[model samples]
Target: MAGAALAGLRIVVSAGPTYEDIDPVRFIGNRSSGKMGFAIAAAAARRGADVVLVAGPVALPTPDGVHRVDVRSAAQMHDAVFAQLPADIYIAAAAVADFTPRQVAPGKIKKRDGEDGLTLELVRTRDILAEVAVDPRRPRLLVGFAAETGDVETYARGKLAKKKLDLIAANRVGVEGSGFESDDNALAVYWNGGERALGPAPKTELAERLLDLVAERLRA
Candidate 1:
C-alpha cells in the first residue's frame, strides 16, 4: 500500500449503531461495536487524509488527528455528517438502525396490572447512504456496507445500485464470531467491474487493505 495514497484528501466515515428511544430510560439498538469504522478512520488518517468520523455510542477512543463527532440516533448521525459537507470521500460503515420508535414515551413505560403485552410502533429511519448519494454535491467516492445473511453478493449488488454507491462491502451477519459486534471480519468488496475478498484478519489490517482499494479507485 502507498503510504501517502490519500494524501491531502478529506474523508468522512459513519460508524456504530443508532439507538432509538422507547422512553427516557429505554431504547432499541443493534449490536455494532464500531470496530470496523474506527479502524477505517485510523487507517485513513494514516494515509494522510483529513478524516471526520461521525460515530454513535461506542466505547472506543478517538484516533489521532481525526475529528470525531459523537451522536446517539440515526437522525443525529445524518445531521452531523451533512453538517460537515463537501467531503472528497464518504464511507457509510455504520450499521444504522433501519427503524426508530414512532414516539418516545416521556416517562418510563410501566406494565399494566392486567395487560399481557405492550406494542411499540416503529418508523423507518432515513437511509444515510442513499441520502449522501442523492445529494447534489455528493462526495467523489461513496461506499456503503451491506450486512446480509444469505446471497450476500446478490443483495450487495442490489444495494449498490439502489443506493448508487461506488462500492459495497458485503458480509454475513449472525455467523459465529463474524459480524455485528465482532472484532475480526472478512468482506466481499464489490465494485463496478470486479470484486475482492479481504481477510478474516484483525479489523485494523482489513481496514488498511480496504483504504488501499479506495485510494486506487480514486486514482483510477
Candidate 2:
C-alpha cells in the first residue's frame, strides 16, 4: 500500500443523509445509505492514503482501515469535516438537508385534536461542501455529488463551477436500479476541462474507478 497511487495522501470524505431534528425523536432526513462514501473511503485507504470519514447517522459499519467520525445533523457534519482540515482530497458524497427546524421542540409535539395541519419554521443549514470550497484550509482536490433527474451534465457542471469543486459525480435518480440507497450506480464525473462516464457498476467497483481518476489528477 505504501507505493500505491494514493500513497501518503490525506483524504477526507462525508457520507450519508444528515438528519435535522424537529424534536427529540422526529427529524428530517433523506434515503442515503452511505454506501458510496464508505466505499470511497475504503478504496482510498487500500490505496494507502490516510482516510477520515465524517458520516451522518447510518447503520453501516465503519470500513476496515479507516477513521470514522459519526454525526447526526447537517451542522454536526459540517463541524466534523472542518475539524479534519488540510487533506489532499475531500469528497462530499452526503445528501445533506438544505434546511432544518428553526426551533426544535423540547419534546414530541402531540397532534391537536382539531388542528388541520402543522407548520414548522425552517432555516438553511450550513453548506459544508461550499464552505470547504472557500476555506484556505481546503483540500487540493475537492469532489462533490449531484443527484438529478434531468439534464444531468448541465446541472452537474453548474455545481462544479458554483461550488468550486475539482470534480462532480452526477447521476440520475429514480432510474430502475440506481441512485440513492442502491448498491449499484452510474456516474458522469465532471471536471473543469473534461469529463468521464463510469457506466453502471457496483458501488465498490465504481469507487475504485473514481479514485483511479482522482489519483491521475493528483499526479498531474
Best model per TM-score:
1
* Candidate 1 lDDT over residue span 1-220, tens digit each: 5658688889999999899899999999989999999999998998899999999999999999899999999999989999978999999999899999999999999988989999988999988889989998799999999999899999999999888899898889999878888888999999988899998988899999899888888888
TM-score per candidate, chains pooled: 0.97, 0.97
Summed backbone clashes in each candidate are: 0, 0
Off by over 4 Å in 2: 1-3
Question: Candidate 2 clashing pairs?
Answer: none
Superposed on all Cα atoms, the candidates' RMSDs to the truth, in angstroms, are 1.0, 1.5
The 10 consecutive residues of candidate 2 with the worst lDDT sum are: 1-10
Q: Relative to the unseen true structure, what is the C-alpha lDDT of residue 163 in candidate 1, on a scale of 0 to 100?
A: 87
Native-structure RMSD, model 1: 1.0
lDDT (C-alpha, whole model) for all candidates: 0.91, 0.92
